[model samples]
Target: MTNTILGNISFENLAREKAEYPRLHMLKPESFKHIEIKNFEKVEKEISFEIGYHRGRKRWCLDIYTHRGIRCDGEIKFFSSIPAIREFIRKEYQREPILPAFNQKSATSNFNI
Candidate 1:
């Protein structure tokens, strides 16, 4: 069962698909305001990936925000151990270029003085 905010696609379903991770929404300082966790540390933070620990839950969780039809606000994938979380992230979150890098040379070539 899934809620309206988080769709029905589980982590397993996502692993099977060929889609890459989604683009991240620009996080503001207020983003952590709602996530009231005491001993939590943001272990990983990237443009589209984030991993944090919830001391109370004793679990490592990754954010479930994606542009690829997997939009979830508060939903997350939790892991039991640090190793498990690391390995899972390595396998699932393949560091692939979702968008082409900006080529400065090409852009500058077209500029007229």
Candidate 2:
């Protein structure tokens, strides 16, 4: 069971297969006005959050909001391959190395991204 909203929200269910910056309609718009794939673009929103992948660091960073925004202050960072990003979300950054599932041919699991 996930205790965080990120864990609760399904990126695939949001229907963002083609969107470079995927977002969702918040059930309760209070916490997250909007959340999308973080990029270099400049966005204008009161409660905007971003999730990005850093190739250099080989990790993911989830920045909640800017200093001028409503959130108090904080950021979540973790390392995950493009395929394993789901695990990062499911585990909420507390991820261990994912081994192959049930003698699968590859390490990648069948998580619908």
Candidate 3:
């Protein structure tokens, strides 16, 4: 099934869970040597969110390091009436769209069909 196939993907497996709160791990700083991220930058805006439109009552924050791939992104939700941030984070992690896989074999084909 499509869900089974998708669940097998690495990114889906990396999705966080509510019980995984306070998730913290140190990444090798060298991985980010090529990308520059200044402090106080808003990285999640580059992604997507449904915050604010429902009301001025929702907020979320994300911290990211460009090199360790999607695993480096951290999310935090802010609101008194909603589910914990970890829940939303896990959902986002699983649903984040990814580029299609590349196929070198297909790239070499020149047939017009």
Candidate 4:
């Protein structure tokens, strides 16, 4: 996949589109899963979120990939207001979670038990 910098676009345009035109942020690889969001975190300086699907041995996890390259696993509590989502993004970016890939292979290897 290509890495597109969010810095190339205007935040106002992204925010307006995210607010007015709700869309499903499909996980990467296209076949993983689809998540619908009526309202999304408004894009801002030094802040961005990535949506992707993670596969485990027994189940799949929907993860939010942060700008810091950390993936926050499990269910996400979405916010309807732009400001709220923005704040969540800020805080989450600070405490970035490790990507599930670290444990994926181990989980599958031990699945026969």
Candidate 5:
């Protein structure tokens, strides 16, 4: 899979999109595109969260994909404003999401999480 940097973490096959979530100020919109996660279906599984503006729909949406589990069930949920998105981000990422370095180190290490 392709790899992209998000703050100090590297996500596979996801590109950082141009957007901003002021509530989630620590998380720069440009650095991280998707949230890489693992879950359990019949067994352990991996997935991602794609959060951004839907140009066609003209709304904010969160796409959870590639797995089925307690938290991520491969669904697309929409929101009306940045505050809603921020709440969701904070909910899903209670303590911040971090993954092992994929291939190379990220350019920045200032991310608190």
Candidate 6:
């Protein structure tokens, strides 16, 4: 898979497209142009919430990849605003979504919210 874009998403383009979310603000401008990320996070097989962003013709929102069991069984859910992403991150990840160093140490941080 390519490294600059995750799936069909591109953070650099997203930022230029004014679609970047708070979690992504941690990255350097150059990082966005070359971001990549793991599709899923494994932690004791608990429910996982992978955040993503999208801007449609009439709306701009966040995407949440959710799974409680099999990773393949996960589903991508869309939220209408960034606050929703923040709330989910706090509840599921036990941290604020806007924290400065959100994914500084992760290999595939493109999908981090």
lDDT: which candidate is best? 5
Clashing pairs in 6: 37-108
Off by over 4 Å in 4: 1-21, 24-72, 95-113
What lDDT tens digits, residue by residue, belong to model 2 across residues 14-90? 23344333232233222323333458665444443445544355455444443445545556555444345446544
**Model 4 per-residue lDDT tens digits across residues 1-113:** 22122222111114543432222233321112223333684433222243322222222223343232253333445444333443554475544322222232322332221
lDDT of each: 0.36, 0.38, 0.29, 0.31, 0.46, 0.39
Question: What is candidate 3's CA lDDT for residue 53?
Answer: 13
How far off is residue 73 in model 1, in Å? 6.1
Which is superior by lDDT, 2 or 3?
Answer: 2
- What would the per-residue lDDT of candidate 5 be over residues 3-109, giving only the tens digit for each residue? 34445333332235532221121233222333444463234445466565555666666666654345545677888853565577668645343422323334222
User: TM-score, each model?
Assistant: 0.32, 0.27, 0.18, 0.25, 0.36, 0.33
Return the TM-score for candidate 2, rounded to 2 decimals. 0.27
| Tens-digit lDDT track of model 1 for 5-35 | 1121112113344423311221321121122
Q: List model 3 lDDT by residue over 1-113, tens digit each.
A: 11122111211112444222121222221111232245966343233332211124323232333324344443434543223333554464544223223232232132110
How far residue 45's Cα lies from its native spot in candidate 5, in Å, is: 4.5
TM-score of 3: 0.18
Query: Which of the predicted structures, 3 or 6, would earn the higher lDDT when compared with the native?
Result: 6
Worst 10 residues of 3 by lDDT: 1-10
- The deviation in Å at residue 24 for candidate 2 is 17
Tens-place lDDT per residue, model 6, 1-113, is 22243332333433444533322221321111112235774344334334444534222344333343455344555665445666765675565443233333242343333
Model 5, stretches more than 4 Å misplaced? Answer: 1-45, 66-73, 97-113
All candidates: CA RMSD (Å) = 18.8, 12.9, 16.0, 19.4, 11.6, 12.4
Evaluate residue 1 in candidate 3 and report its C-alpha lDDT on the 0 to 100 scale: 10
Task: Name every residue pair that clashes in candidate 5.
Answer: 2-13
